[model samples]
Target: MRFLSKKDVPFKEVVPDGYIDIHSHLLPGIDDGVKTIYQSGYILEQFENFGFKKVITTPHIMQDIWPNSSQTITSNLKKLKDVLVPLGITKIELRASAEYMMDDLFYERIKNNDILPLHQNYILVEMSTFAPPINLNEILFEIKLAGYIPILAHPERYSFYHDDLKKYDELKASGFLFQVNLLSISGYYGEQIKSFAKKMIDQGYIDFTGTDVHNYHQLEVLEKGFEFKIAKKITSLMKNNIEFS
Candidate 1:
């Protein structure tokens, strides 16, 4: 099947049907995503129109920046749901989780079991784009020991690991699943990240794909991503996302 960009066709016809988006910042006034209930409602409506059956929106839980907890996420999720219900946008299942930054605070949360996992035990994680954390392996080990599956969000966007692609292989071997962002295939983050995303796809390293939608602009880019050749290929291999949905 051929995929068309939002510009080439209608924006609603961009992504393939039945896509279950597992990572996005759709909750209002929480993180770096939509700022108001209106924005959240609009994005969720767009997701429904775009043919998504479910979307597990993951807000950022960085200590210094967002500092969100499970309670905060759940509360905001309830608020968003309340607003959406009035708009009659209830067919698409909207759930909340957190994309945890691998930092000292995250380690504490893990110990305290204060995490909002996606689905059962799938915890989404990310690192600083400039560098990997000193205790990455240790944290991964602990996550496994605690019986939670660690999913590394957008591994291709970390420029530090671009030169050393084998790190992806190592992480995969260590049981860390990889989730690639859809816009990366459209070169939204630059050619380097796009190249890495292609390499990961070609190597069959990506376990899932997400929109990582922050706003309407990012959503536009995500719509364009469907036109990229890699998008079609990666969509076929997103078994992990499908099973999670």
Candidate 2:
């Protein structure tokens, strides 16, 4: 597996007064994120220190791999809230949501309303970078029919779309919004992904930005990326909205 590194990534100098990091696997003891409530508290503190005012913490809801359910996510989020109450560090507002996987199981699960919705009927979804889902269009259509909007997470990272940037255009044309990972542009994912992020923005296709911070190491890499001019200019847009559904 190709893990993103901090050495190849750069940071920005100027951070906005407020930021909204909509992507993260912050729910502890579940997937690959904070291990305990204490670590969760520390990560929230780091978000405040980094100038973000809101965090729409999104945990993975991939059935085959992560196998996370709404009950599991809600339970962990409740514990996280309990831990943060006494800290008196309320500068950052934390909200819970899930990044869903677009597969057959998800396709049916979504119809039954067994998923947690993010930011007003929007469900954050990720596809296998190895290949586009065979029933991609139909699944998206079903999500829309279910009265939910879909935001494809980190579209540029999917290697299958590398040869065809219009694959993203097709998604946009079909009415799905794209929320990019800030680390991708910072070269935390790779040079190719970083360049693709730039291209997406230049094409005016990016609608949102997120830290996608899973642990302290990712935060450190993101911190470095914040120092670069190009990355900073784009990341500064993450603060666009707060207090969403």
Candidate 3:
């Protein structure tokens, strides 16, 4: 949770333009993201201005907390679009997906084939920062057996894995693609996370990058993140996001 000083560079100068954001919490009032339609619209405008052409908004689908379903996410996205289209905020194509917390509910959903994916075959999943699930590998295997690619969100922020970075390599070997948060490189999450993010980038372990944007303040940090030297280095490594763009 340490905030690093921002480098003096424009965001557009270093970051590639028109990349598709694979993970975000853009739907209003559904989770720990924007609370109102106005907030959602404002952040979407900022994302577009920051060089994102499309945003696949992944709201939290944790059963113990958010408990959002694919239907709820789609309905909320439609409501936001209904307001934004007439207001001329239609430049960025918005889509709905769920960030499935790797918990019991997620396992049940996977078994029932009732989860929402980022694309046709790619699902975004996350674990608790304090500790990983005991059946993490088993769940990942099930996800792949179901014919879906499992993309792990913001692996650098998981403090438990910081001591042993090789855990990242093991997960990658197990077919879990890594998505580092853009702000992690700017030390927005903390110095340790920033260090791990840089290590992942240096080793060419990152398959994608995302804003993981929830509100305006997070967006501000993300704009500053573009000025980080690591941002430019990982620009060519964001193939997973660009392919979907």
Candidate 4:
């Protein structure tokens, strides 16, 4: 028997039933995310319309910048939920976690057990686009020692690692899970990011996919980017996000 031909379908059209989004910046006024309660509501509403069953909004926790704590993130999530319920945008479940910037403060947080995980024992972390920390390996070791699984967020967006593909191997071998930003795959950041994202996906380096959506425009681009055939490759990994649910 001949194999059935595959169709190039828009990602939005074939989104896995009850697809859960693992990362987004839908919290208002906490970080560089939506910024307002109304903005949060609007984004969540759009997420529901896009067929997302759940969203774990991971706000930035950069020192002296976002500096968000679990208290702050939970409070903002409550505020967003309060507004969303009133607006009748409650189809999607909303949870708050933090995208921690690996730094001295982060190391301290790990020691203090001060972290909000995406799920049990899984904390989301990111490196600066400028460079990986000199003690990046040390931090990963500490994170694992603390019984937390360190998931490196948006590894493809870290342009510093793009030219050094072996670094990706080293990171994975070190037991760090990878989360690729859908916006990167969508070419929103640039062709370079999109290309690297596809390459990583092809290499089976990415374990999960996240929207990493900071605003409406990014979400739009992410949706359109799914129209490409390469986007189909991510649909399986998208199922991996339901682990967060």
* TM-score of each model, paired residue for residue: 0.92, 0.89, 0.93, 0.93
| Candidate 4 error regions (>4 Å) | 1-9
Clash count of each predicted structure: 0, 11, 0, 0
Per-residue lDDT of 121-172 in model 2, one digit per residue for the tens? 8779998889989998889878988899888899889888878877777888
Better of 1 and 2 by lDDT: 1
Give one digit per residue, the lDDT tens place, for model 4 in 144-201. 8889998999999888878888999999899899999877876788788878898999
TM-score winner between 1 and 3, please give it. 3
Q: Write the per-residue lDDT of candidate 3 for residues 14-77, one digit (tens) a residue.
A: 5576778888898999999999999999988877776778999999999779989878999998
Tell me model 1's lDDT, rounded to 2 decimals. 0.83
List pairs with backbone clashes in candidate 1. Answer: none
Better of 2 and 3 by TM-score: 3
Which model is ahead, 2 or 4, in terms of TM-score?
4
- Each model's RMSD to truth, in Å? 2.8, 4.6, 3.2, 3.8
Runs of candidate 2 with Cα error greater than 4 angstroms are 1-14, 241-245
TM-score of 3: 0.93
> lDDT (CA) for every model shown?
0.83, 0.78, 0.83, 0.84
lDDT of 1 by residue, 1-245 (tens): 86564334333444556778899999988898999989888888988988888999999999789999899999999988887889989889989999999998999999878888898889899999889899988888778878999999999898887778788778889989989987787678887888778888898888888889999998777665444444447557554577677
Q: Which ten residues in a row have the lowest lDDT in candidate 2?
A: 5-14
